[model samples]
Target: MANLDAPATAIIGCGNINRGDDGAGPAVIARLAAEDLPSDVELLDAGTDGMAVMYRARGAQQLIVIDAREPEGKPGAIYEVPGDVLAAEPVHGVGLHAFRWDNALFVGRKIFGDDFPSDVQVYLIEAQTLDYATELSGPVVAAVEKVAAKIAARLVIAPEA
Candidate 1:
């Protein structure tokens, strides 16, 4: 049970629906829309607006962002990382978007100040394909559901007395 009334918790999912697995982020976010969340949480469908995601995260006590990442792991694999860890991790090569998650963290710092919220977290799901004009493949659709559950679990809040 986490505090849900401190600030808005934003879940930003980015991707191109026309593309293949690149749409994983957006797909997960879409699934979340069907659920009933605490009034303190906000879910945004920020397609490719990695930087803009930070704007929505300002003043949040806990911010959980969900995106698709290509890590050295199995496809559909999900990674849950603290926002600080994602921010501190160095960039070794080109990322999905020019900014990517690193940029999002940086923007978060700039917008909310250096020690930006302590509860920020990222939920990254491994992506299989990034085709520009294809719909999400079969595996990704299933993966989105799993990721959605993970996101919900993370956002869960206990009732206040």
Candidate 2:
């Protein structure tokens, strides 16, 4: 259970490291984990688990999600999307593996209500490939550093009431 009285920011990364660029999210989380972030911020490497994303985000004052987007002509392009714009209701009957962070966003709001953070930001990195591999493409590696630095900078800012 989350402590409703404690105000915190949740940063969740979702992805499959086994798939080439799909590992961007976890990569970012790994980088942030080594940095000195604010005490009020909680970082999670959800690793393709939407349920974990929702549970981890509970009671957070803000939520930031990082993931890789499917290839669409460009590689390593970063898109900062508002959560509401990407949030989708979970489809009934789908297995847990099919559930995604976007679905978690909708379900979390419905389940947690005011306990869930309304300030949600999603950063998507366009992938060059989703093939079975351990190394990230050159462009993705650069983008990961940029995204990690950007998130770290954002965490330093004081939260608004």
Candidate 3:
């Protein structure tokens, strides 16, 4: 069960760490874990589990998600997109394992209504590769630091509503 006194903000990272740059999300979470964030902020290493992302985000005033995207010629490129712009309904016949963070945004809003955070942000880091590996590529490693710093900076002054 979710705590009644949930954190004011939830930051979720989604990706598969074994697949090279796909690990960018969790990598950022790792970086943030060492920081001194406010108690009203929560950091989650969702690691490709959309259900976890959806349930964890409930009752928070804000949600921030980080993930890696397929190669687009520019590895390490960062794109900040509004959650509403990326949210999409899950396909009807797909298994839960196939569910994604975008689907979580759509379903979470429908199920949780106002309890779900309205201030949602998604950060996508362009990938250099998704091959089997345990480490992020050189460029992605740099982007992880930048994104982590950016999120940490935001949390410093973020309202505890």
Candidate 4:
């Protein structure tokens, strides 16, 4: 559990809800919202809004982002990656909007200077489908629940660094 005085661990779920499996991020947000997490752990459903994601996460010391991307393996596969990898890996073309996470980094750095979270983590889910729909695909929903449960459990036991 996090200390009451410690900076928060912010989790931003980024995705388009109308687009089938693209709703993965918000799905995780919904799952995590139902969890009993530390007071310092703040969750946000930053659906397709990179600016809101960055602005909402400004003061957090440790940030975790959940998002959906193209399939790299199985449909429901999940990958945990360091946030700094965004710079090395080009992800500008992954979404229907402008570069989300990557540009948020640039914007945060440019605007906030040094107060932005440095300990950033990203959870990527392999999306099976991304067509127009209100609900997530079955595989994506399973992935969201799995990742959300894992994150909630991890946060409950994880000591704030």
Candidate 5:
């Protein structure tokens, strides 16, 4: 059960805002910014920096991340992913951007030890056009609002997790 008196929940949005549908995270951030959130809830629009994600997730007890996932489905198909699922996937990359939420968790665990949040949820929005575009695709635009609302309902307005 969550300690009502010391609830530390953080909602982080991760993606490149300039890349078409890849901008889903920032879009969700935009929506959540318009709402009145609880004082205990922190919202971070962490662009493609995995280190930033790890740093921000350190102190929170519950963390929710929103991002545009690798191509896996039709655009706007939202997937609610657990941290373990990402950890199970093989990580192949040269630099920081290659490490995503799972990597963030791994780093956090190594550095912060018990201080890192164990409850982590990643909301993935499939992309259609992740090209050099600033605006989100038609489907991803709709999906952003849906995701933003659903996350808000689950974490912010709802009684508990």
Candidate 6:
């Protein structure tokens, strides 16, 4: 079991819910809200608002961000990568959005100072399509559930309350 009193872990799910597979992150976040999670974990639905996510994630001991990525892998494939990788591997928004995780690094570092925790992890799920639709396809839904559970398992604490 995870310790309940650990420092907060910020889970920022970034995506546009109006899009199909691109909405996977926010979809997983919605599902996470329904589940019982550790009290120290703060969940945010960024919805392509990247700068707000950076501030929301500030001061977290561990930050776990989830987003959709077309990594050219199998659909529904998941990746758990360290945060520093964001600086090296920048991402582009799927459609008309201009915000991406790479920009969040600059904002985070500017707000949190240079030597933040090196343990931040980002989980990117492979997206099949990112159409501007309000609903997610069946496969995307399954992927969101799978990714959310995987992220929850990585949580370090139970309810702090």
Could you give candidate 3's per-residue lDDT for residues 48-67 as a string of tens digits?
A: 89999889999999999999
- TM-score ranking of the models: 3, 2, 5, 4, 6, 1
Model 4, runs deviating above 4 Å: 1-7, 88-99, 157-161
| Best candidate (score: lDDT) | 3
- Superposed Cα deviation of residue 124, candidate 1 (Å): 1.4
Q: lDDT scores for all predictions? A: 0.72, 0.90, 0.92, 0.80, 0.81, 0.73
Worst 10 residues of 3 by lDDT: 88-97
Between prediction 1 and prediction 2, which has the larger TM-score? 2
Q: Taking the candidates one at a time, how many backbone clashes does each contain?
A: 0, 0, 0, 0, 0, 1
Off by over 4 Å in 6: 1-7, 71-73, 89-97, 114-117, 156-161
- Model 3 scores a C-alpha lDDT of 0.92
Q: Per-candidate RMSD vs. true structure?
A: 4.7, 2.7, 2.5, 4.8, 4.2, 5.8
Candidate 1 lDDT score relative to the true structure = 0.72
Q: Please write out the lDDT profile of model 6 over residues 44-99, one tens digit for every residue.
A: 88888877666666666777788988737477788878788784424443332565
Local lDDT at 19 for model 5? 86
lDDT (10s digit) by residue, model 5, range 19-38: 89888998998899998878
Q: TM-score for each prediction?
A: 0.80, 0.91, 0.93, 0.84, 0.85, 0.80
- For model 5, name the residue pairs that clash: none
| Window of ten residues with lowest summed lDDT in model 1 | 1-10
Ranking, lDDT, top scorer first: 3, 2, 5, 4, 6, 1
C-alpha-based local distance difference test score of model 5: 0.81
